[model samples]
Target: MVSTVFYVFIFLLALLSYIFIKRNNREPHKRLKLPPGSMGWPYIGETLKLYSQDPNSFFAAKQKRYGEIFKTHILGCKCIMLASPEAAKFVLVTQAHLFKPTYPKSKERLIGPSALFFHQGDYHIRLRKLVQGSLSLVAIRNLVSDIQAIAVSASDSWVSGQIISTFHEMKRYSFEVGILAIFGHLEERYREELKKNYSIVDRGYNSFPTNIPGTPYKKALLARKRLSKILSEIISERKEKRLLEKDLLGCLLNSKDEKGQVLTDEQLADNIIGVLFAAQDTTASVMTWIVKYLHDHPKLLEAVKAEQKEIGKFNDLNNLPLSWTQTRKMPVSYKVVLESLRMASIISFTFREAVDDVEYKGYLIPKGWKVMPLFRNIHHNPEFFTDPQKFDPSRFEVPPKPNTFMPFGSGVHACPGNELAKLEILTMVHHLVTKFRWEVVGSESGIQYGPFPVPQEGLPARFWRESSS
Candidate 1:
């Protein structure tokens, strides 16, 4: 009887211990608060509400109500929106390892999963260094004359009195510059083929991804395949020629793992396409905004024109192209570019996903949740810049507080080609201001999001070439 009683006691003790341990582990999450905000309706979340309004306004409203870090659901995913620079720094710089870069499977399929931005750790580090070296100041400096020529040709093609879409024209110019940086000098046929297919991919990039036979996304998928084949041909030709030059392709071809393994063709194509994709729209958007901003502010236009015209006159007298050094010295134009990037904030936010449950500032960021750093909100925050709505370039005269002005982004994943992008912008502005004058055709001042903010109708404008003095 005493033995039976002892056995019952041990059984009860084990059961109680199991329950206690389980409760401690499971109930902590229940006790922990998620950042405060509405998840909206089940499954759908606030996606419609977000898409229905200006994305900036949607984010601003949330930040105002819930403070810098808030929780919300959009596009069927739980998301944490970080608006403060500290929070952004934590996620992007310090604690980046806890969050991995994330993108939709469909988009990943389109860009090819091998793109460096989709990776982390060693692969990302290796690929980023190569890209940075190719786009470094030293390398791009040598391409100044070539870039100037492309810029001049682009602006020259805009016939006087012809109403052209400035954004469209800028896309062409940026694409050419991207190609120049990638291939040094591609043959005309190859360039044309790449451009033609790339336009299809660009058009479909933001389209609702679907596998329907006639859908834009489907068409993009087809074009992507063709691009792969074309790239293979290019790679074969390069290999046959044994080209050992130092362009991006050359760098990739020559790069090896610790084991001395080179990147596969798919990896090569993906990164090449990735660089082109990154280079095109964002730069074009900013350039378009610069044109509009210059037009809207006549004094600013004259100021930029004067700065550029002086350089032009000097170059013309010397019978020289716009040198890399000349491109760097335009303080006035440079400020205007900075101001434009701030105003547009082309890359409004970036997406990262939590790899595990994480606590930030006493709040739980549950595993698998999306974390987006709202760059536009941080940029436009009145705390950082006085009169955030104003288009004054002088605001940039004093540098913005640290971590508050991330035009290209911050940390490990920041844009490798930012210098090239800036160079292209400065070179284009020089050509635009010195060689031609333009008028915005429509006075309608409104913003359009072609997955990036552009002026409505791509900033319709009429261009007129100035007679040589």
Candidate 2:
């Protein structure tokens, strides 16, 4: 009886302390005219709960309970979640000047002080101009022979009836494309070395910023130094030799701003690595899903194959690569890609912090609050997309409602390499489906969706080479 009384007394004291702390924190922010939403616990916030749930369901539940626009504390910041395309445009496109890109403290620290994705204002515009032009449709056409060679070689490696992971193969293929297009052709041994270190740096994006021994973050920083050293040596060699090849890296090296200021070696390396990092996994994820989607829907698979065959008839099918004009001929392929992008929702949202006190539909979004425009919500909304959950590429026969399809994001902060990503996916998918007929070799429930969609089993499948048949 005495021990039970002691436990009750302890519980009473804890409950009183929680009430007092809650009341204290609430008193100060009363004058801020904040949006109608909970701020959650101080400092720790709602990160624990948010991280534990599937991202799609978490956002859906919140939107259902709190309405289209609501506020919550997540990732240690007080954030406003905008769930409509109109709101997305207002925040991201219309009144974009009122906000700036804001990421978590851990993410910022991992990306470092010089990561180009964090750039804002006039500097972003100028730096973007330097890199964006080369990834355009016109520029991409110039490098088709190289991209085609790599794609064909990579696709040819899967022997008939062998159980292989399409997801794994695509990851390696995307990395190879990045290496050949960005750095020119390197020896297979050197390319493997760069790939090994890059995988290390990639882990840091989702890791804590802690620098203790044995931490992923620490290993990533060390790997970054090695990668930078490799890039710097290549730059030095090109400078000494006066090399000018028709490649992205070559274009970057020769580029200068209007002021005639060239990028420092570090800036060049950061951006080159940035492009590689950006292009690889996201495109690979899309490619993996396309394979899964096509296999699951046989009619769509045959349609894509038929489209490629029709285009192939006009070209030197054996030696000639698909030109920009032939690529444009695949309208069915374009629809399929858009559907995959929407269904997969590769990037979930774009987060920007309010620089000043901002108002949206009379709701006060105070200074320093994170403004998140949710791409997934808009893309999956039934109103904008009928039967949003269904995988039907025919919907793309008509364009999506404006601001609704943001697979690569939109506006000033849009991904400059989006055109390149689309071109790569189209090229890779075109080659794979035309050359092979495949079937799933494992359970389809293996898709792990969160942070990004990944096939847990690497999407194992059996390959049947069309030529062999």
Candidate 3:
């Protein structure tokens, strides 16, 4: 019996070794000639290098060494990182359907199969349409008063001559605004619970899916349960009331398919959670960056303030008595917001998975492989914007090439909330500029990059009332 067991163990080891060798030596598909890249060894091919200390710098070095397109493996999947304008446009616009968001396992683990981000093809399109009407220009105009009220309340809490963390404040403001805009209520307790749940989900982004006692995934799972319960309760309440308010949740509940079919309760919950997640997290990060930029550069702050002053006071912000013609005239505020987005992008890279083999610039991209268009590369490309790192609003005055500056992405999946996000940001910053004077308390480099780069430490700033009263 001992001899037989030994022989079996030896046979299994040999088979595993043979399989590894075969996988490594497999030839590239005849029609799929991938871009040039160094794939080091089997199992752990270039993954460690790709995820090194500074991935952005690493990718930059690789781009310098090996032109626009390069192949690498990440999270056990083969991927090509596309950098050039033509490649980005092709992936984002021309071939968008071929490439869906590439994080199914993560989405499933964090928010379950029902989440809109996990859906593809017709399901995704349908859900997107249902929510799009809420973020339309008219819808935003309707919500302007709510947004301004939240901003003013947040600002009122700030004490002059005290060092405050703008990041936290921005998170609270944006969270409150998102809740009011979507659900039409300012439930503080629910907002607090949702924030805690989202933090767990955020931390689980790059973690292994072992739901063991101390794992991030475990915490994320618990958080998901809490979030889903809250969302379900809200949906139930809305259904019970059957009120016909024009908020996002109302719009979603009322929407129907061409055949008059409505979304399942599960689908509705998932989508509402998706919208809240998207609107809150990224907007908070963007707001933090905008405040940091203004603090770091006083001159820019003055310009933004002057523009806001021209628009009128806090009371006049949501007053539609102010015309669209008048709003269009605030060029400086518009330019400042554009430059802030360009400099401190909220999303570093957008992921997509190829559905089929495709050719680009003499390289064959295989199906099921992930494609990442690094927006940072496009935003900071020297060829498109001279001295790209320099914070210059004038660059946006005359827009660059088609795909040069895509902070909101491009094509159908481009953030539908872009206009509302811009409005929230501009309104908040305008309030800050008019209400208080703030200065950066530390080195600009102190700010760090997470999934989206935000102040590593809460952006601490010392505020004093502006004297120009």
| The best candidate in terms of TM-score | 1
lDDT of 1 by residue, 1-469 (tens): 9999999999999999999999988767656789999999999999999999999999999999999999999988999999999999999999999999999988898889999999999999999999999999988889999998898788776985578999999999999999999999999999999999999998888899999998999999999999999999999999899999789999998899999999999999999999999999999999999999999999989999999999999988999999988988999999999999999999999999999888899899999999999999999999998899999899888888999999999899999999999999999999999988888997659998989999999999988887787
lDDT against the true structure, per candidate, is 0.93, 0.81, 0.77
Candidate 1 residue-wise lDDT at 257: 91
- On the 0 to 100 scale, the lDDT of residue 423 in model 1 is 96
| Residue pairs in clash, model 2 | none
How displaced is residue 196 in candidate 1, in Å?
0.5
lDDT of 2 by residue, 33-70 (tens): 65566667888777777767777788888888888898
Report RMSD for candidate 2: 9.7
Ranking by TM-score: 1, 2, 3
Candidate 3 lands at a TM-score of 0.87
TM value for model 2: 0.88
Flag clash pairs in model 3. none
Backbone clash numbers for all candidates listed = 0, 0, 0
Each model's Cα RMSD: 1.8, 9.7, 8.3
Candidate 3 lDDT over 1-469, as tens digits, reads: 9999999999999999998777667643454567998766587877787666566777788788888899887767788998888888899898787888767576666766666666677877887776777887787776665676788888776765677787778878887777777888746777778778877876775577786987888888888888888878877888898988788889888888889998777777677767777787688888888887776778887788877776666435566433334445668878878888888767877888888877788898888888999888878779998998898887788987888889888876788788778878877776777677777666556546655677767787777766665
